[model samples]
Target: MCRLFSLTSRDPVSPMLAINALNVMKEGHDGSGVGLCLRGLGGPFGEMKEAPILSGIFTEAGLKRLSQVSADIGLDPKYSMTFTPKTPPPPGTPKRGTYLARAFDIPDAWKGLAPEELAREYTRFRLMLRTTGEEQGDMQVFSFWPDTLMVKEVGDPMEVAAYLGLDNKDLVARQILAQGRQNTNYAINLYACHPFFIQGVCSMTNGENTAFIPIREYLASRGVDGYCGYQSDSEVFAHILHYTVNRLGLDLEYYKHVITPLTNEELDGHPDRENLVRLKQACRKLVIDGPNCVIGCLPDGSMFMCQDRKKLRPGVVGGKPGVFAFSSEICGLNAAIPDRDTSKDFQPMHLDTAIVRPDCQEVTICSQLQALPHLH
Candidate 1:
């Protein structure tokens, strides 16, 4: 199993805060890898929210190739943050070339496109770079979107953060998600790290995905451009979310229903049963099986957590008014926000999805057995 930690705040916080929280739950996950995704960025990036930021690891050759490709696509470089470790990586950690998070200006030729069209173009550009890097084994792109940055490395979470200079003031953000992987299911490939991102949706999961192959085939058949990579089974969780809410135009609440639908008997007598039945039938292939707990962030900066039908994995949501954290263990929560009201901390059940809006004010628990309240 992996350890998951996510935080959303009204003010920007360092990614190291999330990394430290993951360390408190070190017993749950072996120190095999660390993955982080930061959204609603602050610091230098706050002024460049309109530009798309490409976050990845690159070789010297890969960097040159990336520049050529971006120019070919008419994307102009705006600003960039490149980190080179001051010292060699610690023992057991692989040595890498350069870490980059470069922002690009949307070319004048594509500035008039609609929002959806523009988003599709970003995905295309990212995938093209990914494919080019794959053939040469020189690049590993994690995310390409505005106000977001991602980093994934194979090592202990805390060590990786310090080694990558993640404590830099400019790397702060209002929301961050971190995962400490145990390396139980797949080989230690950097692309298979947690906290996966596509477009504006990002998610990390703990526990095995028993229904991965079927779900992968279903998602791939949708003819989506960014749905090809399946280096990790948990990747489908994020894609399923993108399909349900972004592509299908469904509300965020329906995402839980699509992945862990209530049974026919459980759905009986519910006010929205008709629609729920239709959703369940139509999205049956997307239903997930196995012990898992998922924490995800949407494009709007909202964060959420849900459990499998059996509630096999552990998770908790707790904090004060200005900041909230979703962690795999309560101890992790206490480590991140120690002053929170302990009584208000919530542990979601099989039928519950605990959500904290971008405001970070309160957590709303929506249940599968009842009609969901209108959430905006």
Candidate 2:
């Protein structure tokens, strides 16, 4: 089952534009979104989609297509797009992406635009839809968000993707499964908002994404378990993985989690107990300075919920705290962060990459998908 969740906070440093997104997971994400900040205005607002593969989210139609085409159909897992940015991004980073499409640019000098303006505009103009999970109370759905994120597979290098709404991709997983080694090796893909990329801008035809995958044989060997539900890319699967790694510390194998360096003065002066900004910086550092195929640990050891510094600046005043929820798409997570979905409470989440040693010759990342209470 897939769940939706997000965090909203208030701070003095950032504007109202949608900030960090959840790190992408192995199950992949469909619906997700972020708020726009233009200041001085508040109302439900939305933007026109530039791609048909990413448009027409009027109601259940688009969402339904997402489940069918992206998840069920098992669309071919492939990658062909490579971006040569007009300018180099931050530096050595993989958590960011090329600007595939412009989601409406804002002037860097807009002090009038508050964060709430973006939240209000999205709520007022956009139609809210979530992915309903069969999992009992509270874990009912993941808010739908249109996304076209692409990831580069270093292991095999396939362009992995996730989408919300109908797209006739029922054969997606099956297509992936078909390519598998006799179904014994199951392929797992993930999507969230934790990006450490160093190039590309937020422009039209430059939407960003992160992709990852692990084989089924490895998961089964570790006694890790998961169920592939319709349109369920492995949201629950991710949650389960989190439990194994963070709570169980299974990552000690070939992968190691190191607490980043922090200053006493900066740490002492900050008020947001979570210190999300520092956490994201560390995750980005993982991709930049760590090893090949780095693992960027998120705010919460388990889920990739809220946006992090790898993607954008820290967030608003008490928007939401905790590493319980993360979104594949900013809008999807934001839409569900404050609403009711059976029983799950929406919240922000953390992120991390499961860096495996090329010499290990095995897979070993344990985690799970989370729930939401969204509707913001």
Q: Pick by lDDT: which candidate is best?
A: 1
Candidate 1 clashes: the total is 0
Encode model 1's per-residue lDDT on 68-134: one tens digit a residue: 9899888899999987899889766889889999999988877999988889898988888888898
Estimate candidate 1's alpha-carbon lDDT, on a 0 to 1 scale.
0.90
List residue ranges in candidate 1 displaced over 4 A: 373-376
Query: Which candidate leads in TM-score?
Result: 1
Q: Write down the lDDT of every candidate, Cα atoms only.
A: 0.90, 0.23
TM-score of 1: 0.98
Clashing pairs in 1: none
Per-candidate clashes, comma-separated: 0, 135
Cα error, residue 319 of model 2, in Å, equals 19
